[model samples]
Target chain A: MKLTDAKAQFISSWGAFGTHWGINRTMAQIHALLLISPDPITQDDIMEQLSISRGNVNMNTRDLIDWGLVERVLIPGERKEFFTAEKDIWKVATQIIKERKKRELDPMLKLLSQLEQIEGDKKDKDVKQFVDTIAGIRKFGGQADKVLDVMIKADENWFLGSLLKFFK
Target chain B: MKLTDAKAQFISSWGAFGTHWGINRTMAQIHALLLISPDPITQDDIMEQLSISRGNVNMNTRDLIDWGLVERVLIPGERKEFFTAEKDIWKVATQIIKERKKRELDPMLKLLSQLEQIEGDKKDKDVKQFVDTIAGIRKFGGQADKVLDVMIKADENWFLGSLLKFFK
Candidate 1:
């Protein structure tokens, strides 16, 4: 495939994949575009290339920045702001894992812990099942939390080399 | 909190959480209901409890079963087919991970590998960047695939005890 066609295909596929993982299509497309770009690009460039509305570019760009996956760049002697994605996929994954752990996992684990304390007789099958389920989830989430912490702190070599080896 | 009220809260929250993870709310809600129920229930029971259409319940339950998180239970002398969720949270999570890895991650890595072979001038910065990005993602996906394979094969005790200890 030609480079341009390949890039377009990659961007669209990445966007579709992102949708299944809770990220919106446009956001992932924008990230894909920025990743393959040799230089930081202006919002107008993104709008023109992706054929998206200005509002969409602005909103998703801000969301990406908030997620720490993208950054705003100011060119010397240039007025319009530009954006760039974190090009290192490993760091990008780590950042996403960190943010999602904070946003989704931590809060869900907290709720599960509270639910486990629901006042009930242990002898009641319903109560016992509910408590057991909650406790199980909390324990699993806690282990995941620890593992992710280690990954976020470690470099890609350590994770891909040491960790993967150990897991294997 | 009262048992009924607590169960309602758990169901709603689980459904909401499921949305963020690409699972539909109704499917997650059905799973939650089955998880908390001490006995297997019929489609009519699910419809009544969730106040959803019979068709909706039918569809999501089938999906849950397909994901291997829910199963059909036959009660002797009972004409109706009852359903129950895998109450062990560890099993439920492993099943989900296994399914999603097949559905999303595996295909994604395959695409990235194909994209990596795009005909291009290696010296061109854009070509280099595109190839590098695809390679990085493929590597990460490969590592995740390996980790998930181990998790799928592991029993709950081995995963929670030995794996957690090794990672820690």
Candidate 2:
């Protein structure tokens, strides 16, 4: 395939993949575009390339920045703002894992902890089942939380290399 | 908290969490209901408890079954079929990982492979960047694929035990 067609395919596929994982389509496409670009791009350039409105480019870029996956860039004499994504895929993956652990897993684990304290007789089947399920999920989530913490803190080489070997 | 209230909270929380991770609300709610129920429940019971339509219950339950997280159970003397979720949290997590690996990750890696072969001069910055991005992603995806494969094939005790120890 030609470079242009290949780039389009990657952007579209990444957008679809992002939607499946709860991120917006346009946002992922923009990220995809930035990931492969050799230089930082302007919002106007993003609008023209992705066929999105200025408002959309503004909103999703802001979100991407908040997620720590993208950044604003200042050109020496340019007026329009430019943006760029973190080109290192390993850092990008770790950043996502860190944010999601904070945003989703931590809070869910908190809720599970609270649910585990529900007042009920342990002998009751309903109570037993509820407690057991909550405890099980809490244990699993705790394990995952620890694992992710290590991943977020460890260097890419040490973590992935150790993990791949351990799995093998 | 009262048992009923606690149950309600758990169902709502689980449904919300599921939506964040790409599962539909109703389906996750139904799965949550089954996970905590000591006995298998019928479609009508799910509808009444979750306040959803029969069609919604039927569709989501079928999907849950397909994902290997829930199963149909035939009672000795009942005309209506019953359903129960795989209550082991580890098993449930592994099943989901397996299904998503098959459905999403596998296809994405395949696309990345084709994109890696895009026709371009290596010296061109755009071409170089694009190829590098695809190659980086492919390598990461390959690692994840292998890790998930190990997790899927592993017994709950052995895998989590080994993983937790390895991480520590």
Candidate 3:
């Protein structure tokens, strides 16, 4: 396959993959472009390559940076910032997981704690049931958080390598 | 907290969690409701409990069924279909992963294969580079799919047990 066609295919597929994984399409394409590029690509390059507007590129780039998936690069004799993505696929996935957990799980853990503390209405079966369920979900989420912690640590090949053996 | 208040909180939070995980809000909330209920909930119950329109309830319920997270339950002497969720949290998570893989990964795999078959423009550096990058992603995604396949088979306590050994 020709390089240009391959690049387009890669970008489009990666963007679609991103949407499925809960990231926006454009954001994923930007990351994919940066990921495979030999050099840091400027906003103009990304815009030209992806046929996206400046604002869309800027917003998604910031989001990618926030997620620890991409980084900005400075070119000598150039005023515009260039960007590159984390090349290690595992690290990219790990960072996405870690950041999402921090954003989604931490606050949930706190809220569950608060909900558990609320006094149930003894006369109200519905209220009692609701509290009990929240309390249960909190317990479950706590365990899931532990699993997340384990997965994060397992980013090292040692854990996966050992585990991959058992799958056999 | 009162039961009504607690129910509202749980639904809202679960819906929020769903958004992060690529599941729509109403679908997740409905599942959350079913998870906590002592009895199989009817369509009316779901619509009422969620305060959603009938069309919204029908659509998301179908979606949940398609995802294999929720199922129809028949109550004696009742023709109306009732709904229930997989109670075991581990099983619930496993089904989610399996369904998501089919929805997201399967399509990308096909697309990657088609794109890879595109005739190469050997003379163009750009085309050559692009093809190589996408082919690399195809390799990466294929490996990911294999890893996920192994995990999906380790249902419920089997997962925890395997993960225990994997992380050991």
Per-model lDDT? 0.88, 0.91, 0.77
Q: For every candidate, how close is chain A to the native chain A in TM-score?
A: 0.92, 0.93, 0.82
Model 1: per-residue Cα lDDT over B79-138, one tens digit each:
999999888777788799999999999999998998999897899999999998888788
Question: Would you list the rank order by TM-score, best first?
Answer: 2, 1, 3
What lDDT tens digits, residue by residue, belong to model 3 across residues A1-168? 555666677788788788766789999899888876867888889899899999999999999999998889888899989898877655666688799889998889888888776666546655555556666667767887887787778746686758733432
DockQ of 3: 0.38
lDDT of 1: 0.88
**Interface RMSD per candidate (angstroms):** 2.9, 2.9, 4.5
**Model 1 misplaced regions, further than 4 Å:** A156-168, B156-168
Better of 1 and 3 by DockQ: 1
The best candidate in terms of lDDT:
2
**What TM-score does structure 1 among the candidates reach?**
0.93
Residue B126 lDDT (model 1): 91
Per-model TM-score versus the true fold: 0.93, 0.94, 0.83
- TM-score, predicted candidate 2 vs. hidden true structure: 0.94
Mark the regions of model 2 whose C-alpha exceeds 4 Å error after superposition: A156-168, B156-168
Instruction: Flag the better candidate by TM-score, 2 or 3.
Output: 2
lDDT of 1 by residue, A86-163 (tens): 887777888999999999999998888888888889899999888877777788788889878887777656645575
Name the regions of candidate 3 deviating beyond 4 angstroms. A121-140, A154-168, B113-136, B156-168
What class would a CAPRI assessor give candidate 3's docking? acceptable
DockQ of each: 0.59, 0.63, 0.38
Kindly list the per-residue Cα lDDT of model 3 for residues B1-168, writing each as its tens digit. Answer: 655576678789988888878778888899889877866888898888788888998999899999888888898899999988876665676788788889888788888787777675546654555556557666767887987787777544576567644332
